[model samples]
Target chain A: MSTTPAFKRLPRAVREQQMLDAAVRVFSRRGFHAASMDEIADDAGISKPMVYAYLGAKEEVFIACLHREGTRLMEAIAAVVDPDLPPDEQLWRGLRAFFGFVGAHRDGWAVLYRQARGEQPFAGQLAQMRTRMVEVVAGMLGRATAAEGREVPATELDVMAYALVGATESLADWLADHPEADPERTATRMMNVAWLGAAELLRGNTWHPSG
Target chain B: MSTTPAFKRLPRAVREQQMLDAAVRVFSRRGFHAASMDEIADDAGISKPMVYAYLGAKEEVFIACLHREGTRLMEAIAAVVDPDLPPDEQLWRGLRAFFGFVGAHRDGWAVLYRQARGEQPFAGQLAQMRTRMVEVVAGMLGRATAAEGREVPATELDVMAYALVGATESLADWLADHPEADPERTATRMMNVAWLGAAELLRGNTWHPSG
Candidate 1:
């Protein structure tokens, strides 16, 4: 009747993260459909009931992973991005931090954030986060535009935000593929495109088709 | 029984396309997994055996739809994009056609192109097409930069191509959402970002982290 060391009670936060880590690994491997709760529970080394007790059902578990990873990523970028700094610096820090996060948490970024885009169930959650990111970027662009005494049209500005976010996500996929690539250098390249393009637009530069 | 009129004998190409159109609609509605052979066959007014005879199985049917939609999209863009033109014109036309295809075939874009990215079975197919696109853009960048008598590092050039492609795909999603958004006009706005940013890079203008 000695106390069992392997079955020691874990705190809620630690257990939840454990479940999520296992969940991400499983989901990344098997996708959302083939991945089973039993597998996740086994992978976490916790019973199925403990998984249910900490996180809800499978969908809830997936959402928990998305929320946790997405928040960690957003916060990682947010922490370094100071609004008072020049917009280029803000963007540089943000992109660097973003690539850094994805580089470090490849599984979370791949399974939770990147893979979630294709599933309808998670689209709302993903869109909410994307909309927030877009708004932040639009605000940055607006501030920069005002500094330059020019403006981008509203609808156009929205699409620009989408383009910028999409570019980062795309590059995130690239970074995930090339583990040897430097996140800082990737961020620098992205800044070259995004900041320069955005600066041109905020300065009211436009392109036209002769047709 | 005198006759059975349920299965009409159409040309192979037309029938294949009909099956694909049905498959895209069904896949978009039900997703790649939940979508069944019975449902898709019924939707196309063909029997289950004919579906198998023509399209093989569920995975094959999904791949066929992806191939069809992806090819059509590529052709549309290629028709408008002339490599002989300036890089900006080439990119502008290419983007306009891409957005147009996505706008017209939102269902295909979502399910076949976008959704397929998450599922492992289809990732290879999707990646093949995307890699081709990245290669084309990279070649264009090389040409554009050489025109400016500057050279972007090989890895950075690869990533710049990825960033540009990702930006376009992100805006394609945006175009899919806003049905009223004009594809050509959106292309102009995108050009303003992509071309300007790219042009700046070709001219050796780059953003740096000052901190």
Candidate 2:
């Protein structure tokens, strides 16, 4: 073998990916506060200085991990959601893809998300991600309504999307906690809760308070 | 007047309440980390030492504020929710009470809850509160199903309740952000989203995957 190390030969992009993978594992295992740079570097088989040089710092590394994971999740859902299909079918596919992603990355979803949820800087990033999710859901709802030859106010669509996204997020938290839970079954459960009401709304039915 | 200060003449319960009121206002105005004991004491017209004696440290005071506010919120909802009423009506009343409370204390909801959500110790407290809310919602759902001479699995009820609570929390966040939104109208919108599907489920309808 050559004198040079194998890792040294890898491209910067590949090295960064390796660092992120290790960082995600460490963050998931030890949590945000307790996690250390040494562990991440050791896990990646890289020197601590090299890890820092490449990813800036632990905070930046965690953010990179979050961005990579979050982007993957969004892409997964988007890939399965076909606008050509009926809206309900599109929603079902999207949900399946979402739960499936969470199921596969349970540790990542639990620690990274729960830890970030309470921290200030990380929470802002999460809010931005949530806003993107809400927009996507609102767009889907708008398209669904348009297909029915009915027009709902954009604000109403936004509100409904917020409710759906919140409900799905709650269930994702539930799934993260319950390792034995089936992702597909969870998706079906969500569809039941989401679609029945949405279908009713699509038909122009609404609940009014009893005066 | 006597040499003893007016505040000293007040009973312990009254003094503690005053301290909490000031703490809530300070925490709301300055956020959890940025809030100071000096400001809270100044607002309460008490010395810093007296504020500390009454509520322990800053963290403890924040916890105290959270407990008081959370209890008041629960009480408000409990007072309006009559089990003898139909499930939908009970839900509507409960939602109205909840949104009304949030509307009235928009600052508290926006700051205290959001700040606590990202911190470790406070997040646990918030989780406990969420669990209580989920249990109450699950109980209501169970009773609703029982009244219809039908029974759903407790786990299913719990999942549905989580979704409902999550959705409501999301909307509460939305409402907090939108100062002009009407609480009662928000409650009505939630009812339309929640009850229509729940009514269908009560009538033995569920969504299944097409495959």
**Shift of residue B59 alpha carbon in model 1, Å:** 2.6
B1-211 per-residue lDDT for model 1 (tens digits): 3242546545766888888889999999888878999999999999999999888999999988888888888889878877789888888888888887888887778667667886667877888899999998999889888887887777878889999999998888888778888877778878988888888888888887786
Which segments of model 1 are wrong by more than 4 Å?
A1-10, A34-39, B1-10
Model 2: chain A TM-score against the true structure: 0.92
**C-alpha TM-scores of all predictions:** 0.90, 0.93
- Per-residue lDDT over A11-31 for candidate 2, one digit per residue giving the tens place of the 0 to 100 score: 877988989989989999988
Worst 10 residues of 2 chain A by lDDT: A1-10
Local lDDT at A70 for model 2: 90
Best by lDDT: 2
Model 1 interface root-mean-square deviation: 1.2
In the range A59-98, model 1's lDDT, one tens digit per residue, is: 9999988898889988998899889988888888889899
Q: What is the C-alpha RMSD of each candidate to the true structure, in Å?
A: 4.6, 3.8
Model 2 C-alpha lDDT versus the unseen true structure? 0.89
Q: Write the per-residue lDDT of candidate 2 for residues B1-211, one digit (tens) a residue.
A: 3465768767877889999989999998988878999999999999999998778999999999999999999999999998899999999999999999999999989888888875778888998999999999999999989988998999899889988888898888888989999999989888888889878887889988777
DockQ of 2: 0.71
